[model samples]
Target: MTLRTKYLEPWIQARENLERRDWLSKDKEKEETQTLIDKVYNALGSISWSANIRGFSNTERTVTLATYCTDEWLSDIQENQMLDLLQRRLQHEPGGQQIKVESVYFYILLKRGYDARHFTCIWETRHALSSGLGPSCIGFLVNVNRNHWVAVIVNFNSRSILYGDSLNQEPPNDMLAILHWWMHHHTGHRFTTRSLEITYQKDAFSCGLLSFNALAHHFLPMEYPLIAVSNVRNGRLKILLDIIDQHLDQAGVRHLQGRTLLTSLFDRASSPSVKNISSPSLNPKPLLTLCDQKVLYLPKARLG
Candidate 1:
């Protein structure tokens, strides 16, 4: 299906239909559906903002299901209680991680007394091998009312850090380029998809290479060092950074900073690494990256 028909139209319809529904009567069945519709509307609003940054201009881009639960019923009491639990947990946590949004969504639903679950999917090019390549796209599949719901949550886990040294394999060129563009525009760090190629002569490993988009300012201690290589040929880009790390300290910092080390291989025939290397060949120069970060400059009360 076209991206518009798949992602944008459905969400628009869902939101409109949701806004028109009456929920004050509290009929059990209608209320249940209303709750789900509310969640879907809110989730879509979140997804749209997220996708806008990734250069996905088409509103029809659909959100894939991640994981979901259908057995439990939702109630206000349960939802409020869960929200309290989540608020307390987040109090001790650091901000800016991708999963934080997901956690917030999960807690919001729970606090609102809805039974929900999470599911993830990856968007892959026709060339990607189905077996081992990680999901190109990932998001949660929520059980709203009695129906299933899908909403994209880009940047949900995009901040994972990858070490610069000890890379062994290559990743898909497009993936690296997009990611590089995203990190630089969204975050303050200026990193680049340096190169992607094959390595490990004996076993013949395909890897994706990336480095800092721009070297750190001389005065700064280099708070974040960019380094990542993924095995796109074999479809194990998700674990690329962890495998190449020489020290847990470096790797740990990257992981905590939410810098991504994973790569997506959308083609099976050409090693993902090969795709990365050849990207510059096909496209004269890298496209100007779009900034995905949304800065909320208002006070807390103003936000609501």
Candidate 2:
């Protein structure tokens, strides 16, 4: 099947970007990228041709991911959906780091009501507290007036909440109030809150991508630092490829062999996008680092 025109351009642009960046120096690296692109192309073709795919299964989710990979912005809810997938992967990590990824809806619900009973129930019902104790840390994204996105990570280990905005703006007061109440309810005391040092977005429409990067920056033990703002386009492409790679793996089609999406990503050792930052380090042993859609550490303990 012919790759759709919409998808064709993105893949072509991705190939061009890879070559222009000189990331594919070796023949093996070039071949690997081509194979990965072919798989993404095939996946895009499959979903475009499939019938009656109404639900947001792995296959259906590909549509949203494909759009994102092509440098389009996604809704707050869509960002949460992608985060949910990453949350699942994080759970399977080998370490004892217990992390909770809250949905944008979770924040929405907080806005509607601050009932302690209601939230406590919701937390328990959703298994937010795995061992009858809450998770080590809770991370979530906030949609600022439905216009821009920001990432907030509450690290119980450090007893601090890091608010990350690519625009370097202060967090909304109401949102901070909700967080203050929520944390007190969970821990019997207020935790400190501060702004996380984040890469500024050079362009609009990349906050969602940067939000993902922020989460990875504070939690995942990535070999490199946070992705630079200028490289967010490439970041989106890598994210889309990671989503496609996982979808193919889940659907039992992992034959195409070479460097994994992240492996290939790190191949660009000289790319300025992999700039370092001074932030709290996570357990350097996460079985899976956030491939694109991106941890926290705390001891197991009962909530107060």
lDDT (C-alpha, whole model) for all candidates: 0.26, 0.57
Please give, for residues 1-304, the per-residue lDDT of candidate 2 as tens digits.
3323332333333333443434433564555445555444444433322122232232342324535544457676457655765576677775424787777766777655574436643556235533446677778888888889899888777778899999988888888888787777666677898887678887878888788678766666562268876566556656665565555555665443333332332233412221221123521112123222111111112000
- Leading candidate by TM-score: 2
Cα misplacement distance, residue 247 of candidate 1 (Å): 31
Error of 1 at 17 (Å): 3.8
lDDT score at residue 138, model 1, on the 0-100 scale = 22
Model 1, 1-304: lDDT tens digits are 7533443333333322233432322465455544454343333232221121121111211122100111122222222222232233334545312122132144233323222222122112111323323322222222223221212222312433232211343433433444444444434465533321112222222211111111111001243223222212112211211222312222233222221101101111211222343356432122111011121322233111
> Candidate 2 versus the native: TM-score?
0.63
Please give each candidate's TM-score.
0.18, 0.63
Model 1: lDDT of residue 32: 53
lDDT of 2 at 79: 74
